[model samples]
Target: MREFDYERAADAAHAVATVHADPDAVFLGAGTNLVDHLKLGITAPGRLVDVSRLPFDEVTERPDGTVRVGAAVRNADLAAHPLIRARYPMLSAALLAGASPQLRNLATTGGNLLQRTRCVYFQDPTVPCNKREPGSGCSAIGGFDREHAVLGASPECIATHPSDMAVAMAALGATVRVLGADGEREIPVVDLHRLPGTAPERDTVLHHGDLITAVDLPALGWATRSTYRKVRDRASYAFALVSVAAALDLDDGVVRDARIAFGGVAHKPWRAFAAEDALRGAAATEENFGAAADAELAAARPQRQNAFKIPLARAVLVATLRDLAGQEAR
Candidate 1:
């Protein structure tokens, strides 16, 4: 690991200003992801502004039925929170579905959203990775890309974002509260992450000084019927090959409303807008669910080894929707 100076932040304003003033400074939460990058020589920041102990660690509920999760809240705590487990079960399920118990205990909400890709090329500094160093070239483009992206990829990079929590948040239409150098702003979770276009180095839309303070989940009464399903090589402690976060609202035998997002298929959480569009006002059936998946995945561009992801993603989406709709029918 590289030598660096560390300072515990006094407050949110101080943390934002400190990191914003220095281009080489970065905020430290629980050091779950950042510390790994530091040891791997992927990132070597001159200063670390410790924000783990800051006041941004509470999970507050508003009268408007919105739940705000602090950035510093541990993943385990967030997942186990009574309100979260009760109201936003999909979010809780997604959180528990990620990483190991030890990691979940130490990982923070902000750190999870800011996590880099798990692609081997991006982690190994010895090889070429456009995400690690722009203009270098993407090693995963033609290399072993079994776990690469099938949607929202560019010639420069095909790496997918690895955040199960973000996928659920996208389906829930959560908003991220950020404190930046300019001021404060709220960005929708779906909009926070962008496609890996020419600039594969940029994972999120957040500016250099922007600090995520909390994530707000708006009240969607039907969210209680939501669920998250993930498929990987193994059962646990594995990144998803294909995953779905879905919430369905059924009116009699027809779909009244729906929210769907896919993971492990795109640069960011793949929001299934087309699928949702196809489901609304349509019959809640397996055939319709398959058609909805087909509508959304029609634009999928799969690579050689990972062409299977397209069908896998389709199956996962259909199954997830069927399961949610079945629950609603009951």
Candidate 2:
């Protein structure tokens, strides 16, 4: 561990100002992911501003039915929240499918969203990874890439975003409230993460000192019938080889609306916009589901070791949609 200054912030304003003033300062929330990077020598901040005890820990349902989850809310608490489990079950399931119970107990909603790729190359300081050090060639490009990206991958990096919660939030169309030097603003969850373009080092659009206050999930009645399905090599504590977060709205066997997002396959959460467009107003059948999956995966550019992810993703999306549609019918 390296020597660093530490301060427990009194409030949000103080936290934001302290971090924004120092270029080498970072906000510490739960320190679940940040600490790991610190130990691995991936990041070294001169100062750590503790924001875990801030007032952003509540989970409230607004009058308009939007569920606002404070950034500091623990993943376990959010997963077990009555409102979350009853309404947005997909989000709850996604949270549960992530890290083990011990880690989830300390992981915060904002910290979970800020988690970087779990690519082996990105974690090892000795390896050449663009995400770890910009301009260094990506080792995963020609090396072990079973867990790498298949969609929206640039030559600079083929790493995938490793957050199951963000995938569910993307499908749910959640909004992230941020506080920065310029004051507060709202960013859609889908727009929060960036594709691995020329700037693979930047995982998200968040600039330095931008603090996530809360995530607002819009009231989508259809999401009540949604679910998150993750397929991994192991049964527990394993990241997804392919995952699907899907919601369906059916009326008399016809799909009225749908929302879909795929995980473990892209630089960010792969929002199935093409699939949603294909399923809208169409019959909610297995055949239609296949068509929708195909529409979205048509743009996939799988790498050598991860070509199987394309078919695996297609199967998971179709099966998840089918299950949701069936549940709605019952």
Candidate 3:
């Protein structure tokens, strides 16, 4: 690892200002991802601004029934919080499904969102990865692509975002609050992550000096009936091959509303807007659900080894919606 200077940020403003002052400075939250990158020689920032001690660690309930989760709130604490377990069961379940107990205990909300992809090529500094080194070309595109993305993937990159919490947030319609050098601003969770277009290096829309303050989850009564389903290579401590976070509101066997997001499938949490659009006002049946899932995966372009992901994603979506419908029926 490269030697670097360290600075302890007193608060969010100080963190932002400190990063703004140094072009190569990076804010350190839980240090789970940053530390790993440093050891792997993936990132060697000149200065490390520790923001874990900042005031952004509280989980508060708003007057309007919305939940405000500070960026530094630990994943385990967020999952076990009474309000989160009671109201946002999907979010809680998503958090529990990720990593292990020890890592979740140390991983913060913002840090989890900012976590990098687990692509082998990207992790190996010797290999060429567009996300790691721009214009160097993406080795995953023609290499071992079983874990790569099928949706929203450009020819330059096919890496998938690895975050269970992000999929839940995308489905729940959460908002991200950030403190930048200019001031504060809010970004929707769906818009927070960027698709791998011509510029595949940029994972998110955050500015250089932006410090995430909190995540605001709006009141969604239907989320009480939501669930998260993940399929992976292993039973535990494995990233999703294709995961679904779904919330459905049914009225007498007809869909009233729906929120769906898929993980391990795209550059970001892949929001199934087309599927949701097809599900709304449609009969809550397996056939209808299959059609909706098909509509969403219609644009999926899979590689040779990972072509099975398209069918797997479709089945997962159908099964998840069917299971939710059964729950609603009961």
What would the per-residue lDDT of candidate 2 be over residues 1-330, giving only the tens digit for each residue? 689999999999999999999999999999989999999999999999999999999999999989999999999999999999999999999999998999999999999999999999999999999888999899998899999898999999999988999999999999999999999999999999999899999999998999999999999987899999999999889888999999888899999999899999998998999999999999988888989999999999988899999999988998898888773322
Total colliding residue pairs, candidate 3: 0
Sorted by lDDT, highest first, which candidate order results? 2, 3, 1
Candidate 1 — number of clashing residue pairs? 0
Q: How would you encode candidate 3's per-residue C-alpha lDDT over 205-262 as one tens digit per residue? A: 9999999999999899888988899999998899999999999999999999999999
Q: Give the least accurate 10-residue stretch of model 1, judged by summed lDDT.
A: 321-330
Each prediction's RMSD over C-alphas, in Å, is 1.7, 1.6, 1.5
**What number of clashing residue pairs does each candidate have, in the order they appear?**
0, 0, 0
Residue 33 displacement (Å), model 1 = 0.7
Off by over 4 Å in 1: 327-330
TM-scores for all candidates: the values are 0.98, 0.98, 0.98
Candidate 1: give the clashing pairs.
none
